[model samples]
Target: MQRQFFRYNAKSFPKCYRELATSSSIFLIFTAAIAGCTNSSLATKQQPATTQLFSPQTHLASQPPRCQTAQLSVSKVSTNAGAGNVAVIYAFTNKGSSPCNLYGYPGFALLDSKDRPLKGVKVIRSQGTYFSKQQSPRQVTLAPNGQASFEIAYNQVRDVGQSCPTSEKIQITPPNAYHHFTLPEQINPCTGQVRVTSVQPGIIQ
Candidate 1:
């Protein structure tokens, strides 16, 4: 009697009811696939934004432009003459209309009276008490017509038989700069080395 009752119920069910159960399973599967596709699309859209948030290029893009040689003017302001040694402040003025940044040490090369490059002389960088005691290179932003300075100190007297040549003109390249300017002044590197300080924001002692 139980087997007969089960067969009667199965035979009496409508065809649409069976189709509804099958379609319900298919609807659930399609819904899950659609959700997964939406999640994948969101991740793809967010990946580039995440990479750009931490990229170094993004940081560099926000910094001020580097100073160029043509935008600067170099001059000799004054010098502190001591016993057999002198400290000179070379001032750099930003002559351009736009602002720029300067950091690190300026490149110094010796020149003869005729403004020719003199090789073999080393320009030594110093961290003496004459300048600010910053251990690291500090970025100096210069507005139009603003000034910055660096110092060069060396002995005026050299030991006998040592070669200490006199420089008539000095070529100075600002920090991280490819271009240079020439200062028409005389300097003597007694030990073949001129002690230079990094570029400071203003005129330093």
Candidate 2:
């Protein structure tokens, strides 16, 4: 029953909502990631400009601190729907004076009118969606008043005798941040599944 409204590497962005164990498997994955980064660096000499532009670690010392929820704000910019699926694009504008960075996927939770989490809903991060083809998560630098965006997409199918659960608001926690804020938007996803893309530069269509 899987269709391609959104796509992601399960290896890179697993079920992020759950807690991970501090085990050898985690250590091995980290080791592999570092190896991959090192290998990419070897090719950097061949593509100096490309490497400098996309590689966040090239000037890691100069990169701004991670964007905290206190330094930014989110808005539901626009939405697209078709072929029984819908995608919503949201932007996080840097409201603080200092520049900051955002990388990877934001955490999301749908809450009912009473502020309890909606049951039976699943949310996972994706690398791309039907509306946009984007790269894997990279550091998105946000200068003062600048923005980075991501998309939340889901299927909207209903069965014959039951109605989808109603959500009265949306909760968003920026990547690597512990706290969250809520948006007063209603949602009703019948399939109980949702996909979110990693944060990227500017507003993505």
Candidate 3:
């Protein structure tokens, strides 16, 4: 009886040892998997980020300068008559160091003895042989120290009383629709019409 009991105890001891070994192997695998997951999460959080910056030297080098005007002067004036009206001719010269490109129409304002602005002055295009609101002289490319001419007509001489001064004030405006590389200058009041024959270089056109 004693021998049979010892044999049973020995057989049970081997089975118990096998079950303990299996449980220990499973626990070790689960702990290793959890440690690997934690390491991956930490690496993702520690990654670095990127950014950009600007400097003064880079900003200024990217921008362009503004346009400037050249000087202008009135050179000559002449007068003529239509069937029932009078006309005045004006010659202007550019005496600047740079070329000037003329843009848009040219108009004039007649001033009374008191310097009051008068309206209804007509600009005539001798080259076109026609009349309109105002003649934007051709896009004249005036070389440094060059000259150009334009005419103004008064449909009725009576519009300007006999005592009125022959000269008129003129303002040469650049084309509003386009960007000008150079600007136009203002012509002071002169006899018959404002004549711009000479101008300082770098004057706004």
lDDT per prediction? 0.81, 0.87, 0.45
Residue pairs with colliding backbones in model 1 are: none
Tens-place lDDT digits, model 3, residues 1-205: 3555434454566888978878999999999999999999999888787777667978866443221233555533555555654445454465677665554344344453445454433333233222323333345555667655655444433344454334343344222223222212222222233322212222222
Model 1 residue 40 lDDT score: 95
Worst 10 residues of 3 by lDDT: 196-205
Q: Pick the candidate with the highest TM-score.
A: 2
Q: Which stretches of candidate 3 lie over 4 Å from their true place?
A: 1-70, 119-137, 157-205
TM-score of each: 0.67, 0.69, 0.39
Q: Candidates sorted by lDDT, descending order?
A: 2, 1, 3
Worst 10 residues of 2 by lDDT: 13-22
lDDT of 2 by residue, 1-205 (tens): 8876766545665555323544567888999999999999888856545443577676886769999999999999999998888899999999999999998999999999889999989887789876778669999999999999999988887879978877899999999999888999877888898889999999895
Candidate 3, residue 59: Cα displacement in angstroms equals 23
Q: Comparing candidate 1 with candidate 2, which one achieves the higher TM-score?
A: 2
